[model samples]
Target: MAKLTDEEMMKMMESADNAVTGEGPATMAESNDGIAPLTVRKLMIIGCGDGGCNIATAIARKIPDETFVIAYNTSKRNVNEIVCDMKVYVTSDADEKIVDGSGKSRAYSKDAFKLNAYKNLLETVNIGLEKMPDISYIIVCTTTDGGTGSGSSPMVAKLLSDNIDVPVLLMGVYPSMDEDAIAQYNALEWQSEVERIGVPYFVLDNNQHGMEKPKVHAAVNNQGAMIASLLAGREFGNSSISIIDNRNLYMLLVQMGGRLVAAIDDARPSSGQTLDDYVMAMLQKNYQPEPSNVKGIGVFIKGSRELLDKMDTSIPEVQKKYGNAVLRFAHIENSDSVEIAVLLTGCSEAAPRLLEMKNRYDDIVHAQKEAASVIGDVMSGMKNLLGDPRSSKRRGEAKEPDISALDL
Candidate 1:
């Protein structure tokens, strides 16, 4: 066989550069013009916990039909609730015994997914993915506050990064400050492991937009969907305008790999809200430090076709404000209300909120330890108060029937 010429080589490579296209059996096919436009990278998303499953399923519901979405967890209940393209359940631990859920204990969660259980998850995920030949990227979604997702997601991501020759990104949902200390500390632990692995990631602070469970979950889901659109919405969004096609998303995610990228949506902007207001709010709420370190920004705006024409001017305002950042836009017309999503890449990873959470976690642990010294055990409180008949008490009381055992 004769070797191809430089022209042929260049043409083949220039067809789709870098980590944009998925390398599957159908990754390449012939078309009349030449090679088919495999330039549009395919995205494969896996949601790892209840919060993760909900967000992934919610995104699948809105984006263009046929977008690959999978929800996985140890809980049958969570797996049952998810309605998506695929559902994967870990079932039970390595020994093949069925288990219900992690019950909020990350340690127990990690253990429960051991041996056979772990292999089952890996095999199941691969089996589902094997059918899709053109998988360009893999996104792992999970909640940092819970037991199942929190314990298993980092391990899953790290393992997948090792096993599969694909770039893996993580979307972590951090619990609200008002949540229990278990959740708060769990969130921090998840952060530490994710960072150690060095996969680029972004987080959504629960209760940042609302306090109620449904409201918080909805806000998180919507925000995640907006980011998904940024990466893959070109299929759904009208392509005539500044559409964020596969190449654009490839640039935002893969080419600029290993940076904190956030695409937050602020919907139904009031008539009074300016572009600056929306951008600033999106940045702050998403835990981005400031726009200074942000190397790239992709904006998606949707509105009435007539009104969107006027909003075109708002697109350029981002560069004017951030200076030096690369800017792009994806415009979708015919929405009932105006909504804007701003995607930022290369922002500072040391978000102030993370530090605040760390300090809060430390304070909480310290406070609990301090309280432990003075706070009597609830079960033994009455027994201590009543004094023991067989033993001497700290208060110099005679040993009575130590009602503590009796008290309990």
Candidate 2:
């Protein structure tokens, strides 16, 4: 049997869509009800500065023809230069609110670029939407802890949701204890905010994910690569085998992305598999990995004994398929169920920016906490100086207190 060429696959996709819509199939060769089969027409990667830029670049590199609109707050820096031919819109006019992702300023800490940044960001999105009417996915990769990525991403998600109806997949990075209070606070707030917006978020922890280098561009490249693969019917970690498993993972991302997209557009979604079912389906799909590609698999088992026992049954098969790919196991004390997250890094060069960011995450977090504390102290002092209720006196009864009148 001859494998389907790119053109054939596309034709099949068109046929599948026709079948699902009851318009008759385009080609009998390609018709499936799976959400992954739904073709992605356009994607806009908002907030591409710091690590977010790398994520955007990865997607840009993967799909040269796909229209990618990058929204960055740093203008003079020209982060767009990193993203090859994709269109870029930098919010140089947005206010100096904490620009998340590496705890950096969205405006390069310049007063000229401060104020109206949020509105500028929204405008960028509007332009992108207008330009790419067929956009099916909007992936916002920002730092949960830093300034621009942290602050702008949620706003973009909200504005986009309010205007267009499409899936918004937010990939946010969380800083470690090293990032300090402000960075941590910003990250937490953004995550909570995006969650409140009811968007499916994929969060990566800087502390947990080990990287080999440290550089903004490098880090994003690594993360961006993961995002591209995960979106294009590829699996992460240990679960990339069995065509069914790959399709299952691909469907999970598409379903999640589609759910948000549908909600944003105010369109009703056809009920499909629950999150639990999706995970289980992926787990059940055999790990018949390509032997040559297999290097090592890291197993993270965190659940009830029953779940562990079930996984125990499947370990041998996984080992047999990947030539001892199992690497490590992490036990979560109170997990209710099992989750097998996979990462396949087939001898590729380690992303340097990622390592730099990971190494500095804790330090940056600490600095942010100190900054927050200092601000809090300053505000408290100002409050005390301006008005102390206990020391207050009636306006007419009190004489004007003069600093010059006091003895030096």
TM-score of each: 0.70, 0.47
For model 2, residues 1-408, the per-residue Cα lDDT tens digits are 123456754554453333322244222223365433232345667654465665666667766466465746443354535673333343333453343222354233223223455456666677777877766667777666666567667666666666767666776666654555566556556655765776555554454334433653354446555444444423212211111222322323432221111000111112453322333344333121112222222232334544444443224454454333222121111245344444321211123423444446566667778998997787873545576775778766778678885677
Which lDDT tens digits does candidate 1 get at residues 19-63? 112222232333444543233455677888788888788777766
Model 2: residue 71 alpha-carbon error in angstroms:
3.0
The candidate that wins on lDDT is 1
Candidate 2 wrong stretches, greater than 4 Å: 1-41, 78-81, 84-123, 126-131, 208-220, 233-408
Candidate 1: 10-residue stretch with minimal lDDT: 18-27
Cα-based RMSD of the predictions, in order? 8.9, 16.6
